[model samples]
Target: MKVYLWVDKDIPNVYGQVAVRAGSIDEPADFTGLAHYLEHMLFKGTQEIGALDWAKEKPMYEQIIKLYDEKAKLRDPKKDKAKRDELTKKINELSVASSKISKGSEFPTLIQAAGGTGLNAYTNFDQTVYHNSFPAYQMENWLKLYYDHFQRPVFREFQAEMENV
Candidate 1:
């Protein structure tokens, strides 16, 4: 709740933002881009937004990760192209299967529906920020949205987002 406000009567809308003091500088050497990855994942959706039935999706997700690990171990491109391609195909199929039951992009859609503008986030050396602009009267709605957004965001679509990164 560390909100810093700059009030000006000339403007009809308010620019609100949230930032966490964790970024690349805070990431471990072995996981250099984890923080930035997390920043990107934040928009993918929370548990309530982008999610499938956990009871069924969990086991498949685990199997996909295991397959990816196995593929990584055989990293010689020229020597393992066929095997790698097979593993990749399997991963993609599993991902699509999992996604079939999940819902995503709900958060941004909510903001947009509320007339929010500039809905986005970014990660830099020392911080990760999520920000948006809304009409002055929507402050209460904004607070609630922020609360739900950060409470427990589910890392949905990990493989796709990782590929994007």
Candidate 2:
């Protein structure tokens, strides 16, 4: 059965989250970070939330991968200066394009329309959490914002999401 809850100061706030009960540890070695990436994408919202222009989001998302890929290379104490600089350039290019997707976009405006703030989401080692804290009256709006994504999502791409962490 469907249920509802809230989290706030006045009335008691209630909400829900899904626990996968597994993670990268359970995936095939070839899958590597696939599980981790999928965790992040889960919150990309779904067809129901709104259309996710993946065509355009893809290029932006790829740069996100470049950003993380460069960071990974930098971690090596013996990493070559030339190679590092090359990756850095790619990352910068991608970061710039990715920022465009987030600039004053309607998504932020709609999420805020729910009558609350701090409606955010995250992915972790063994879990993916999608939640928000709003005043009691915003339950329906909040639910609409969260439902389709929680039910089924279309994330930009895991490679893009890694940039956030």
Which candidate has the highest lDDT of all?
1
Per-prediction TM-score: 0.73, 0.49
Clashing pairs in 2: 5-14, 6-13, 6-14, 7-13
Q: lDDT at 56 for candidate 2?
A: 70
- lDDT values of the candidates? 0.82, 0.56
Q: State the lDDT of candidate 2 residue by residue for 79-108, as single tens digits.
A: 576677776677667656644554323334
Candidate 2 — what's its lDDT? 0.56
lDDT of 1 by residue, 59-141 (tens): 77678889879997996999999999999899889878878776657788889878899998889999999999998778788
Candidate 2 wrong stretches, greater than 4 Å? 1-9, 12-22, 52-109, 157-159, 162-165
Question: Which prediction has the highest TM-score against the true structure?
Answer: 1
Clashing pairs in 1: none
